[model samples]
Target: MSSAQWNAGQAHGEAQAKTEEWVKSAQNTANKACDKMADSRESAQHGKEQSAGFIQQGAIDGVKNTLGINEKK
Candidate 1:
């Protein structure tokens, strides 16, 4: 076999290995981004639930005050 042919084969193999490594790195980055987004969504949902509870309690309290129950208690 000629040296030129062997060199070309070696170069092609190296290029293929580099491409695989880049693909793996990109996949890891994408997975981490997805995980962060899920965590943020869950946290926001929990916060919304807490806010809604507080608003509902305030409305109940307002009704009790209007009915004079709050003063009686």
Candidate 2:
């Protein structure tokens, strides 16, 4: 092959390699962001459940207190 043709092929190969590297890097970043979002969602759901439990308990206690059945603690 001529020197010019060989140089062009080399440049093409380098460009392809760089593009692939960029794609992988982008994929990794997106995956990390998605994982963070999922974690936040799970944490929010857990907090909601805890708050609901507290509310239910308060309602139960209110009923007992109104009936003069409050337990000694």
Candidate 3:
């Protein structure tokens, strides 16, 4: 085979390898982003639950105080 033909084949092979490597890297990055989003969603849900509990407790305390249900003797 001629040198120019052999060189062209080698260049094509190298380009294909680089393209495969880039695709794998992009997939890895996308997976990581999805994992972080899931984690953030869980954290936000937990915070909402905690805030609801606190508000419920405060409402109960307000009702008791209004009725003088637990006034000090």
Question: TM-scores of the models, in the given order?
Answer: 0.90, 0.89, 0.88
Name the top lDDT candidate.
Answer: 2
Scored by Cα lDDT, where does model 2 land? 0.98
**Best of the candidates, TM-score:** 1
Off by over 4 Å in 3: 71-73
lDDT tens digits, residue span 15-47, model 1:
999999999999999999999999999999999
Candidate 2, residue 13: lDDT:
100
Candidate 2 residues 1-73, lDDT tens each? 9999999999999999999999999999999999999999999999999999999999999999999999956
Query: Alpha carbon lDDT of residue 37, candidate 1?
Result: 100
In every candidate, how many clashes are there? Answer: 0, 0, 0
At residue 12, candidate 3 shows an lDDT of: 100
Instruction: Please give, for residues 32-68, the per-residue lDDT of candidate 3 as tens digits.
Output: 9999999999999999999999999888888988899
In model 2, residue pairs whose N, Cα or C atoms come closer than 3 Å (at least 3 residues apart or on different chains), thus clashing, are none
Lowest summed-lDDT stretch of 10 residues in model 3?
64-73
